[model samples]
Target: MKTKITDFFKLVFPSTYSEVAVFLFFIVCYGILGSYIAIHYRIIFDNRIPWDAYFSFDNKSILMTGGSFERHPLSYYFFNWVREFSLFISGGKMDVNFRLTLAWLSNIIITLNIIQVFKYLKNIIYLPLWLSLLITLFFGVFSTNIILSFTPENFTYTLFLLSLYNYYAAIKLRKEEKIPATALSLAGITIGGLTITNFVKVFIPLIFEKDLFRSWKKFGNALFRVAITMICFIVLYLNRIDFKYQNIFSKTNQQYEKFSNVKSMPTWDMIFSFFFGGNILFPGFIMSDKHNMKGFNFKGLYMDLYSSVIPYFFIAILLILISWSYIKNFKNKWVQIIIISFLIDIVIHCVMRFGLHTSYIYGGHFVFVYPLLLGWLFFTYRTSSKMMSFLTLTVAILCTYLLVNNIFRMLEFFWFMENYYQ
Candidate 1:
């Protein structure tokens, strides 16, 4: 039995268990630390962290109102609407419990969707545990969607991950010429996610590709696409965001975002932002309160303006750094797969960060690239082996610190529960 298991590991995994085992240590950090941070955001930050320093301090009253982004600020209303609708059914009974349950339920959907994305990638890409662990660690810290927790962005990110999985499923199904029932089902699942918010804005067009959309014999693909969209719309209405919320729509605002495209910055700003832009390496800067925008010249859009510069630098540096390596080992299938995945994600999300498609990974879509890059880097190259071990240790120590903080918070929650329930 031991020999058989060893053989299975050798066949399925890219490297020895040394790296993967270390990564597991980090997972303990992420789960415990991440959960605590999330609850803290709920209790202390109210609904925002990573950026709660500004906008509506409310004398530390702890509320979740408007978000940082205008496009999704409507989500603020949506969550409240959820709380209100629950009250109607509760008839004022167990009102606090109902609101708390809804809040948790929202996060549950996002977390489960992330799990599904990893599961899908595991089956299709055959990534190893070490790869997934390293990537998940990056997501836990830096990804805007994950960092922002319990918001529309988080929900949209979940759908985005699901949409990618469904996309890959469709690709396989189409190759087989007859769409599989399971693929159809998964495709249907993502449509609701997309409609709830523009989660897969960049890649939605790929779903309705010219060939796929034009072909009637490919009715399964079309049906799956349309079905999910309609279902998502229905959900939105059922959640009470139909024509009644027409006031939320804005013709002028929508037009600016869609048509009046912003130009990408020069190469220098892009490079500067990568190191200091606060997306990674230094995320606190973007969320810092010291740089108040209220009095700044570019007041309304300072965050968006500055944050957009980093990914271009990442793309340039990444390409230049990887150039010699790629040229030297062009024939390697593993290298090709890694490069393809990165490019596919970039191309699929080009519009998100102006015209520079290569930069999208540094933007709100960090989760998409974090896993793919780390997976490919750790498994494809042997250099990361030692670094991975050190990172694991670092995260474990950090997690211990985080755990003590969580105990206090958890005690606070318990105290509140006991006093309130009684």
Candidate 2:
């Protein structure tokens, strides 16, 4: 066992053990940082307050009582179950355990995402493991702000990634002879369940259709599996105690409309500001008009510093280059599908006028885009000259450095506000 583990490290970090050491160091640092932020930003729901209030009943009863049966019913239940487990372990009290549960889940999801991306790069572009980690660490962490906030969205988001991973695996299996029946069945369930969580996720299966649509027999098998999934969804939907078919669409539409007309920053405006909102060096958090004071109130020095470093034009040009790289690889069906899905997400958000706020944009929307950009870079220049590699490495280091500095500064400012400044 020890020999195998050592061999794995040697495989990942070839010549010296130095790179392996560095990777482990970053892993520890990020683990700590992610846990701290998630705990710090823990949100209380269902009118629960005082940080450590005890629940009124047994954990099982608490979990069964609070659920949004109208949408993502299973996920809603899952979120409550997680909270109940935390409360159970905390001896009927609500405390940091709730946030800790979420933070741990978020960290696990991020690790799984990194693993999936690494596998994709290795299989598709023959990328070395070390380079894969470097790129994944920089962009993965940069795009993970959404996981910090404890919300049902985290559960759905992690489910989405799981579904995507399974779908990717199915596609790969199909490429080699016939896909096993078990693989196809699991893929169908994951994708189908995703629809129940977020209907828009139904489109994700299409991302792999380029490889699945070669022959009628293959396509027919895929359809049969999906049919099974849809039937399962129907049964679940019908079983929900609060199920009201007529009111479902109307309720969803109303929520969408409410979000669109939020008296804060318009969806369109928030998106545009995101580019100019320090997205290159650090994550940007934009407050809306709804949260603004009636009179002038300071948004604090950290916010001012965050707002001051707007490298909009530079970042825009970099994005253009990234897009060009993907276009250059359009012949690769996977590349084409990924780029299209990402663009579809952008267009849908722009038109729907929802998910344009800082949190949503930072948290969830950029997920599709990150993989496209990261994959394109490694695929396009995997065997490039050392100078190119050097430049890429430099950019990764700079982004990591700036991101760590940004996190520390924000933490310091928040601490000061809570302790000394206030």
The candidate that wins on TM-score is 2
Off by over 4 Å in 1: 1-31, 34-114, 138-140, 149-216, 219-249, 252-279, 284-366, 373-422
Give per-model TM-scores.
Answer: 0.47, 0.71
Deviation of model 1 at 354, angstroms: 7.7
lDDT of 2 at 234: 63
Worst 10-residue lDDT window, candidate 2: 50-59
Best by lDDT: 2
Clashes of each: 0, 0
Q: Evaluate model 1: give its TM-score.
A: 0.47
lDDT of 2: 0.47
Q: Rate residue 331 of model 1 by lDDT.
A: 62
